[model samples]
Target chain A: MTTAQLLGQDPGWLIAVKAVMVFAICVLSTLMAVWTERRVLAKMQLRTGPNRVGPAGLLQSLSDGVKLALKEDIIPAAADKVVFIIAPIIATAMCFMSFAVIPMTGVVNLFGRKTALQLTDLPVGVLYILAVTSIGVYGVVLAGWSSGSTYPLLGGLRSSAQVISYEVAMGLSLVAVFIYAGSMSTADIVGSQHQHLWNAIVLFPSFVIYVISMVGETNRAPFDLAEAEGELVGGFHTEYSSLKFALFFLAEYVNIIAVSALASTLFLGGWHALPGLGFTEQWLGGWFTLIWFFAKVNFFFFIFMWLRGSLPRLRYDQFMKFGWKVLIPVSLIWILIVASLRVLQQEGAPRSAILAFAAGVVIIVMAISSLVERNKEKVRSADLPEGEAPNFPVPSLPNVQSINVSGGK
Target chain B: MLTIQTPEAVMFWFLAPLAVISAIGMLLVKKAVHSALLLAWVMITLAIFYIAQDALFLGIVQIVVYTGAVMMLFLFILMLVGVDASDSLTETIRGLRPIAITAALGFGGLLVSLIGRATLGREAAGLVDANSEGNVQALAKLLFSTYVWPFEVVSALLITAALGAMVLAHHQRSVPRATQREQAIARFRGASLGSAAGLPNPGVFARHNAVDVPALLPDGSAAPNSISATLKARGDMLESTQFELSEVDNTVTEEK
Candidate 1:
């Protein structure tokens, strides 16, 4: 594909403008996301969050940023001074870097030059995103270690572990999309989806898995064991103050938008209009597609807010177990199914034949799982004492009161 | 956006020395955590070197794996275990340090020789051709088709190593564990043999948060709380540390 088609390799000035615009979009959207999150969460809780700052608290995040900028920046006596200072900057910067590959809209006319609305696209665009996010873990881990404090250290470790675990599942989920699209390029993935149905519909399980992984990836509520306020104090940024703390905050919201945009790109058809709303794109062209893209991204962001307001933070161990044992395996199975289907299709298998094969595979898998469950049941039943009835307290068990008295005596 | 051009020679000269300095710093740093961080910096510089050579995929992977996951693991372990608990100065094995130095020197010599013999960038000459087919796909095709067996073998080995690690780390208790109900009852009855310190004091008594009022002992003297009592009992607390310099001076003068 031509550079013009894949991405707008525009004049240097226009490209610079696009870069500035992307930065502005990320920062502005983060401000809006923070405001929207507060307002939405407040509405959910039957309270107004920050109406005093701007209209419906639109400028509340801005004020908070300003306040943070003015706060006393404390570098703890024992902290590794350099790492401590650099960590938040790394976090925020790395978070923004992933947006370089995101296809914001279709080809658009800018300053009388036609170009696709993206910063740049690599052949390994999706992998580049994964690599960047992986590197972002360093910011947290380093921040925690450099703090020279207990809570931040714990928080940082938890964040690293959480990111590593969920990232695997997230990567696996995307593999199905890559298989279906036959390319890893973000623009190509979107183009492929436009040619057919959205990957979210075709690969429903992968989409659901990606949604869950994105929440976990961003350390949002339910999966946010890393910064469980009830347990970890302020988490990795506990010792961070002033602009440094704001940077971490900025990185987090930016990351959320980036991941949401990625989810839009990968599964929701990027800047493509909704299937039923194709008329909007047809009439308005590329600009309307940007609207659809942002709308989808914001919709994901809304779900993120709803989750934070609704769900309790998951226990660290439970979160990890779910990531490793449930999500990874399920995604693995789904990828297997998708890969086989693709291979069969490539081999000129008829549609019905492919569907039948998929059904047979699913049935076999279900049967095996049920068989294992039945065997477990049998083993558990056998392990019970002969005199014990199922679901009843066994008489052979020691009496709690007597045991307590004996221990005391 | 500004049409920035990379001067590869300048970048290599800059990053290569930084990488070497950090690698040496990683070895010499007294703190394990600092050493890990230094290693991460080295890894990052190496990634930049890869990027300079147009191996963008390799560069990203280097950062993603080495600097990110591996270094994080090292730092995590260092931090969690406490930086103070670093390896002891005393070598457990006799002549181990000399042997280690000799081995390292020999390895370095071999590497230098190998590098001097081989034409540098010869292997990398194929990078442009690979880039034409898309680096990721090209690399993937080569790895899966040409080096397929070795790749599969390495993957299997990694899996085996993971399984082995899990097995080694697994602890099977010889004694049956107490039921949660039993443990709860024991705790409630104050019958559990919790620790040598007995039940911890609910109030602050010593160190940073000393209370103005002390606990009255059964014999009427003010009793030390958990932390102070533990320290005193273990003979780790110095008597002079608990009092003012004037009081200690007075006591010493009176004794003299």
Candidate 2:
């Protein structure tokens, strides 16, 4: 049976169980992700991270959660009380909601009933995820505004603009996938990749764009201008304390995991085993597929940590410019190419002809890009004379009289 | 009669009242942010209703386009304009309030009557066949084939609107922006040279490195400019005299 039909046959009790399981998995994975991030970042930085809580500090997140819950929760006097409290809940809830459509495993037996390990599969599953994540920004925006502080407000504004800009690129990037798969449903998209080349290989540009946009979408590392510590003082959560702050933290990590899972689903073939390990998918009544799904997710998560440890945060204007000028336009062009190719394949065009057309498109793109690069170079050179330092304002030094320490002869 | 399933019926019954209440609250809320939130709630409930009716594609689009992008832009503007900004109750135009109330009532009545007449006594046709090949595919087939011209026109109109917005927002600078070098020259030549060397560091030559301590000038007086303007305004600056050389004996004493 197809995953959708299997999902439809799930009993109420089984659905409830699956819901609880998804929630537990999300929360547990968030904890592990936090630990992994810290340990990985520390290793990159030449330090030992969190070794005192449990074995290898596996329980450190739990301890931190408790500590946060026990600490004082301060509400600034100037804050809008209701929205301030609701913001974190909105952020965290939206993060978890994105997981509802993500397929974690193939059909598996649980309590003597067959079902797919997903909460629900809407027809427009991927769109649902995008919508939920878009709403998630309200948490940060409202948190910043309701705090009634300068820094948080600035952080919130930056976050709103940043997310809106990247979201356009992100959405456009997904268009290529939808065109190739011919469905917006996550399960269908994954099933389309079975025994075939992964979308990551066939539609490589879209995958690359999706990866970059996902990082920006989740406000991570180089694109994390929203909570730039050196500038905004914790960003939108500047005034939040205790559990409220922890919720935002949890929301962030969960959002990372959610987007990673989505990347796996859309581009990495979801719960499919590796190229040579198809047999493992049949083991354990298909429950072993979960391992493959999570492995792909962890691969993406590691990239997140690698970026966080190595890359510096991008300047806000440069980031916005890249999103709008580079990512969005490239995605639009890629979508056009993919759609045309899809039409050519449907019309039974000759293979050699298709290859020639694709190659011609690539050459044109390269030529255009080189021309743009040369234009930029010309502009840069024209802005300043060769072999001369660009003039910048420098403060004049204070005049000091020379002190005659040596006595005159 | 429209056949309503148990679960969908339950959800509609539960959310319908909440949606109506929030829509009303959107109008009643004093704060712009609160009003925006209420309208967002209303939009969400409407999306849910769409999904329950098997229009999953439309429902999600409603959420993505409205609650996600449009409402977010609204909230972004509200935050920028100040969250507490509210319209004055006093009407600027004479009899404008009564006219507005009457116009709203007439509009609402017209909409209710139109919808009631259209949907009344009709069996609701479900989307089972339309969605047989999948909702997105069906929608795309119609969009590209039957409604292709209108779709293209709508897209063109959207692009035109965006271009119009850009034209409206774009402004030529009335004067050339001052470059850093020009700004520096003006700073040095236009005014006194007290700040020509740069503002003095706070807590300079002080007992501690706290920012609240004003720097000691060459003549032993506190330099007010050295301390932060915020600290000075808040009366948080420490007494500079307490840390002066005369307050403590400088005689070296050996420990026994």
Candidate 3:
């Protein structure tokens, strides 16, 4: 029933097989996400996407990938070739590695053998995911440095700093989930939420923080200033073309899916039996779990694509300020509140009492912040002349370019 | 105790060949950038050797920090301050240097073999369990437990190195950063490419578009404007020299 049970039950070779499958799924899913994004966006805007390719343009991604591979591989004359080449490889590899532990559709029939859908689920699976995803920043940083071109270099640098900043918020946001689940193993976390109540419902604030941070982590829409086409031209992969470019794109979408799947598992109860579906031990118990798991995952994936269409891209500076000043602080406070609730629960306090205490704490904190802001504003109003420009850091070029290209005026 | 059997034998699996190739590559590369790149490869392969020795944390730190960060700094400095291979071309220094480098290469190979013999020659694959021994969890536990002092020292070393880099970058050298460049184009942010200064009016540079120079800096040279010299050095200086062809007709045309 727990993640450890799922992981330990399998022969190690099944894990190896699942790992390979996860890698394939990520690569294939990314291709699909790309094609779907284009097609769906086209339908929204009354433009044709790649209709003439394979059936329903499903195979267009395949053709594009092939063409990209066959294209001329041009290492920039002013670039660091070894680093440039290795950057995308590392990015793509790390992306593949993240899904190795993800429960796709838990437990599937593999040549008559039943096992957990995950590759290798450890007790510290949550920390493992964090550690693995952190490596993604290396690709961005290396891509920028290796290119030796100013813009790509800047884009890489921005994305790395941006990712590291958001990861803190993201990591903090995860703390409450860990506390609620009482285990870091993702499968265990899901199993702990078996009372028909998801962590997303129990820890709504933490869930919100995690969702925002997840979008930022994957360098998705609004948070995708690193590759803002208008400003960066191509961002980190500006100089990269052919197969190398495809790899970067593949890594982005794959990482997006992996992160989304993780979100589903942590907050939405991974691979749990949906109320509508009949539960049966007649089927391979583990494989049945995978089916339920993918349902939640697919829904989240659609949300990712939907958000891409619905929202406009975010400004760079605004994104950073939100992550560092807003998200981090909010998550930290939420974590403290969650910890207090856990302590109260251990001490035999009623759930209602704990909830009331949390609400009171939130209100008091809000009142204090507002009071401080008002005092600061009054002091500033007394000192400054009318129409005087507020001093701010000389906005970095990519930050400026994002605004300028989007016709921000 | 985790015993290493025939440590000398294990080191030879990679270290023997790695040491030879890196030493030869470093000395053979004429360009400073090329040599530095070669040296990074050497450091990386050496780290791989470390990984084989069951030091996962060291391997990752070597890759993430040294190859990723430190070597990057080395390359960036090499580009930001362009090097002249011509400086290494003094006839008097060259004759003696070849012998010196050749001797150094031989000596290096001998040292690698001796080290390999001393350490890995004794290490048998039979000794290593090789099963998840140096994984992140295992490595973390090891660092926090018995190896805590060395682990703490490593962090201090990293901080010191970072501060030292900052200081070095800020220090004023005899040559200004921009001046040493063959064609330094600074503060000219016209377009995203920022290659406009490097690019001629197209018509002036070549007739048939036979060359991609000035408009393109050669690989490894950050100075886009200095690309003409790079191309000339490569003996691919476009189709024709602008001085003779005069494709621009003196006044420049705005290219699309």
Candidate 4:
């Protein structure tokens, strides 16, 4: 059935319950994510993580949340008090708002009220998430400026630039999915993925680009240059304290959850079981799709934490260059190729012919580029002084064993 | 005619006033930062109106483009330039207010007259109902097909604006910066000794000593640093001087 027929079918009470449930799920997931990150990271570094709280530190996140709530809230005497208070609220609210559009699984019956797993699915649901997350940047920027300090302002500015740069790539990467799915609705996109191979295989380049850009979009390490502790202090939330600080912290982890959920929805086939091992919706009842969805999401979450533990933060210039120069252009080109392939397929062109033409085009482009590069190198060498080589450093190779049974050199 | 009980009517009554109030606040606010923020509020309220009308694409674009990118650019500039209340009090352009008011009134009049003359309708021609296909699909169909040229031109305009900004921001420095090779050569020739000049004798300056050890002069007396000055100022220079007990026997004997 179309999304509209499914939407608004539930009574008002049901809708409210579903919304509360969604919020609860988000909070629970974030708490788990926090505890897991600490535990996993500690284990990776050969130390025990927070184990004083409820059994293996599962309730540690809750206690941390409580501590944050009870901490003394401080507003700098010189701060813009109103904006300082409003900023974190905006951040947290926007983060929660994007969760409404994500469909956790296929249709589910809750309390005899049949409804989609999502809160509400608009035809423009994906764009709604984009718009909501984009507005989240305002919270960070205002928080920085309202702090009446220098470092926070720097952090805020860095975040704005980072968001804008990565957002373009993120949006472009999604375009290929839209084209392939022939719809912008998240539900429809998932449905389309079921008809063919998952988009991860079909749109591999877009998938890769989206993964990279999502990391950049959420400001997670190694792209978390905005909040680089070695530099901008605690970044935009430097001046925030108590519950206000907790709100920013909550917003950040919630945003990570939202983006990971989105990535799963977009590229990992939403709630579909992996398209192997003869799995189907009827195999173990359709409700098992929820497990698959969360499993995929957790995989992405683990990747995020692994990256944080392994990779250093990217320098700001290198980060921006990667976004604008590499990611954007590559995605743009991939979109062009995808678009043309779709057009050719629609026009009844033979698959072999289309593939051959695409291959030939790529070869010609590469050949021409290589020829141009050779000519440029020849000109550069000819312009140099004949006998004087530039004093370029060459380090000797570290001690190595030479083979004895070799021809004379 | 719209009924008061309708959702759109209620939304209009609520949000329109909010937008107006915020817009007014933007104008009347003292701080430029506050004004910029209030302007963002207005933009957001307008976006809400668009969503209320079921123009989801328009609403999302409104927030994403104007509220997100444009106002962000505005606040970034305001904070970076650090414009305070004192800066706004000075009139940089003398006698320009009257001209601006006249121009604004003329533009408003033109807009009003155009609207008044146009045929007003509750239902516009060739328009699909809001519950039809997704507005994004409808927009894309129209944008990529019939209205493609104008859309491309608008993007080109945006590109031109970006190029113009780059050009305007480019500055050709009057004195070129020293290359790394030049700096290295200068350093090797001892022409670029840094922080070496104007430095006080290491053991003589109080701050220079790692453990706050006092500096010593050639005559084995404590050097006249800030530490010695504080001791002298307090009239305990003779009694508290560590140099007298340690190595300033000659100077102490002579002074006494």
lDDT tens digits, residue span B37-136, model 2 = 9999999999999888888889899999999888998888888887567767887999998899999999999999999998898866567878888787
Which regions of candidate 2 deviate over 4 angstroms? Answer: A376-409, B90-125, B174-200, B203-256
- After superposition of all CA atoms, the RMSD between model 2 and the true structure is 5.1
Q: What is every candidate's C-alpha DockQ against the true complex, given to 2 decimals?
A: 0.20, 0.36, 0.04, 0.23
Backbone clashes in model 2: 0
Per-residue lDDT for A125 in model 3? 71
> Across residues B16-77, which tens digit of lDDT does each residue of candidate 3 receive?
68777877988886667667656766776776676666554466556555665456556555
What do the candidate models score in CA lDDT, each in turn?
A: 0.81, 0.88, 0.72, 0.81
Taking the tens digit of each residue's C-alpha lDDT, what string does model 2 give over A62-94?
Answer: 999999999999999999999999999999999
Off-target runs (Cα >4 Å) in candidate 1 are A1-8, A282-285, A350-353, A368-409, B1-6, B84-89, B93-95, B102-126, B174-256
Model 3: DockQ against the native? 0.04
Residue B87, model 3, lDDT: 34
Worst 10-residue lDDT window for candidate 4 chain B reads B191-200
Chain B only: TM-score of model 1: 0.61
User: Residue A288 error for model 1, in Å?
Assistant: 2.3
CAPRI band for model 4: incorrect
TM-score of 3: 0.62
Model 1 lDDT per residue over B1-256, tens place: 1233568777877888998998999889887877877888888888888877778788888887777677777777777798367767998999999999999999999999898778565554455677888777788888999999999999999999989999999999998876544445444445333332344442222222343334332222344543465556666633323442333221222364
Top-lDDT candidate index: 2
lDDT of 4 by residue, A106-167 (tens): 77677876666788887777878888988899899889988989889899989988988888
